[model samples]
Target: MEITIEDLPGHTKASLSGRFDTTGAIAIELPFNTLANERRALVIDLSNVTFMSSYGIRVLLRGGKIAMSKGAKLVIFCPDTAVSKVLTRAGTSDLIPVYPTLSAATAAVS
Candidate 1:
């Protein structure tokens, strides 16, 4: 997996590409958590993520909780169908909002 972070006007965007399985989740966990720790508003771009596993969901849930505890928010955008289903099934989508477009995600965070 590859993680790219960009600073937007009112929030930070982190784009994840490749599979979001166990290995991928491990690879990104630290940086994702770091962003949650530091950023007030975080937008996660998952359009390029092709696959997601339970571990990936765990990572996202952890990040969301961390952000919330810090009085921050984390949202996901552009998730493909497979990833979207995984998130929904895992109930992660209920805790963290998922948007169909980047604009919508950024707006929610903003």
Candidate 2:
């Protein structure tokens, strides 16, 4: 699994791929923690992500909480139905905004 971070003007995007859960926490957290240092707004891209668990959803929600605590907007994009289901079931979607497209997320953050 890989989590690649890209810096945007007012936010950051973490491109997530492969299985994202307890097993991939380190990889995911590295980029997320990077975003926490400088940027307040964050957008996690899930276009390439194939698998997710409750722990993966926790990562997203936790990141969201951190971003929001810094007076930021935390948006998640391109989450497939399977991944979305996990967050939905965990009620994480209620806290984090899920965008169907990167354009929408980028627009929101920008």
**Top model number, lDDT:** 1
Q: Candidate 1 overall Cα lDDT vs. reference?
A: 0.93
**Model 2 agreement with the true structure over 34-105: per-residue lDDT tens digits:** 575558777888888877876787777778777777887778896557877776777877888788889898
**Least accurate 10 contiguous residues by lDDT in model 1:** 78-87
- Return the clash pairs for model 1, or none: none
Q: Candidate 1: RMSD over Cα atoms?
A: 0.9
**Superposed Cα deviation of residue 96, candidate 2 (Å):** 0.4
Residue pairs clashing, model 2: none
TM-score of each: 0.96, 0.87
Query: lDDT value for candidate 2?
Result: 0.78
